[model samples]
Target: MNFNQKELVKSTVPILKTNGTDLTKYFYRRMFKDHPELKNIFNMSNQASGKQQHALAGAVLAYAEHIENPEVLINVLKSIGNKHVSLNISPEQYDIVGFHLISSIKEVLGDTATDDLIEAWTQAYNELAQIMISIEEGLYQSNLKKSGGWKGWRAFIIADIVEESSEVKSFYLKPKDQDLIGDYLPGQYLSVKLFVPELGHEQVRQYSLSSAFNPEYYRISVKKEQNNSNSPDGIVSNLLHGKDKGDEIWVSAPSGVFHTSFATDHPLVLISGGIGITPLLSMLETNKNSLQENPTVWVHSCRNEKVHAFKEHINVLNKDSQWLTTHVFYETLSEKENTSVKEGRIDLSELKDEVLIDNAKYYICGPEVFIKVQYNSLINLGVAQEDILYEEFGPQLLHFN
Candidate 1:
């Protein structure tokens, strides 16, 4: 905890980086061996994907590198906290993770990881973990402090349900506890947990706040994930498929940092693909009343019109607001079916033409591949790197260059 001790741990960061991957591998092995119950919490498919492992290694090394200045890691820590919260991981679970992580480092580093080094890392992990715990606790308290928002997964009665598409449905939820619901910034997401009888324990998934922040209710649009019978059915989506208007579902407070604040009056451009339209829609709806004269453009891509969610609401907004513009691109629509709309994925040419301003603030949310392609195109098309913001759906990964 002292300066010298902190420096020692910071110096050991490079040594750990050399063994970071191995340490994470050892840590997971030990963790899963000790607590097999956690196997369900993490995405085993992602584990097989290898990219998640590399991302975790990079994150751990970065934390160890910045151990002395914990403030420098606040953003990273907050993201991790949100992910953990969505997974229903608790503070006690963190203790288990920290133990395995620290032990793995000690075991891998051998003599270089002296008792002093161990003590320093122990103190550092405790401090970092506590910061994460406190941050999450604050979020939990804030959620529960409101009239409608309460602690721990409370039931929200589905007041209204509208079919957005053949596969997706929009559910307007009202807290069963009170008439008032907590207000949230545009572009935030809520974690919904369901106790699926088939999946055994409760499974959690984050759905973006499709509806604008309103005092009376909250809304989320869910696309039911269907696949071949050979594959396992999606736990949460399938459960939502059978639910009716009167059914109750567990909900968490809106939590995400990818929100639009009243920071600037710069022209706004939002780009999305498929179901990624949820958060961006919230942002657009929230800013509908802005007095600023800046124009807002939304460019969203989907397979076709049948699968598009919230088309009617967006159409109504388009009719009412001249400053708001929306361009929908479908990958598989006949010219006769949709002659006015462009037909293809988002690319540099479309973005250059549709995005009115070259230097406007940009917000992106979509599949990883789509994000990567569009991000590169944006930078290549004269968009400033700093002005571009993105929110990945799950398990944090650095944005592609």
Candidate 2:
């Protein structure tokens, strides 16, 4: 964009700060009204919860704030690009979004929407759209070049479903064509699209792959989200839970940037809370067979043993691998267990000697609050900011200084 356009976008920072969410909410409503078919690609549950709006508002605000130098936002853009690619977003869809977004801005601004302001925003939005399209296209091409990978969605059959816990179940999926599946990073996730009879539309949700790379199949562990007063039921998750063996579902190739490298010999610390263990389980499984002498520690927290998925599997791993150490913390203990079990929330202070090794890398996965608490605790314990990586299950809303 030109200098004037950049300045104009930067000038809207104050307005975006004050009414960003409202603007995004209006934009989404207008877009959905005009392009109803797009509902199949977006997560309606997040829309109803206002999470999509807030996430978009924050992203837009950040873009405007850094309008003068968008290069700095490349990492953020790449992350979003991965998500868009996983949802099978196309370049043509950006045009529709741009139209509705610009219209929403003009409609919401009313008399203040001068010709110059609208023109400036149009140019700015077009530039950003092009950038995103380019990123997504590159991602699409990368996936296509991978072995056994294809663009867009592919049909997969649920070969089996195992009850991992009271709330969590593992779905073993294989390609409907009975062909070999592509390899994905241990911590990456795949998008699953399902038609919800209750919503009268298709909903797409990304679930972390819970197992190591396998050419035959992919496994995803899903925790059913029960309906509550604060939020509606997880439409896609509930629908998936009700699905029977041999049911077919549409799945996108795995995509994410939150994976770790098993090529290194550094000590690794994997921490998770509740169902967040899904991705971390993949990391642990992939790293367990490594011939390196580096140690790996698995720390998990949940309500109790009944809801703790993969307890036996983890126990077997702990017993067989001398390089693996395990710890479990329960919010409320039902009975006295072994040395690995403790009663309370996760406290890094208690495991300092085990986790504070030299050049140790920390990977945390959980809710936003849990991530923040653990991140801050790690910082307080003298871990470098760059050494700690975390992944939140939902939108990328967490900001750290």
User: What RMSD does model 2 have?
Assistant: 1.4
1-401: candidate 1 lDDT, tens digit per residue? 88987788779776666877777777888887998778666665455555556678877777778776778777777777766665556889878988898898888888777898888889888887889899888777776787566555667999998898778888899888766677777888888876667646656678899877878889998888786765555667778878999898888777777888633377889999888898988888777755563578988888898898887888898888888888888998875775757888877565577784845889998888888887888888878787888887766676342
Q: Which parts of model 2 have CA positions greater than 4 angstroms off? A: none
Candidate No. with top TM-score: 2
Per candidate, the number of residue pairs that clash is 0, 0
Look at candidate 2 and give me any clashing residue pairs: none
**lDDT (Cα, tens digit) per residue for candidate 2, span 1-401:** 78887888889899999999999999999999998999888888778878889989988888899888888888788888999999999888889999999999999999988888899899988889989999999989998999988888999999999999999999999999887788888789999998878778888999999998888899999999998887777788888999999999999999998887655568889999999999999988888755663689989999998899999999998999898898899998865666568999999988888889888889999998999999999999999998898888988887662
Candidate number with greatest lDDT: 2
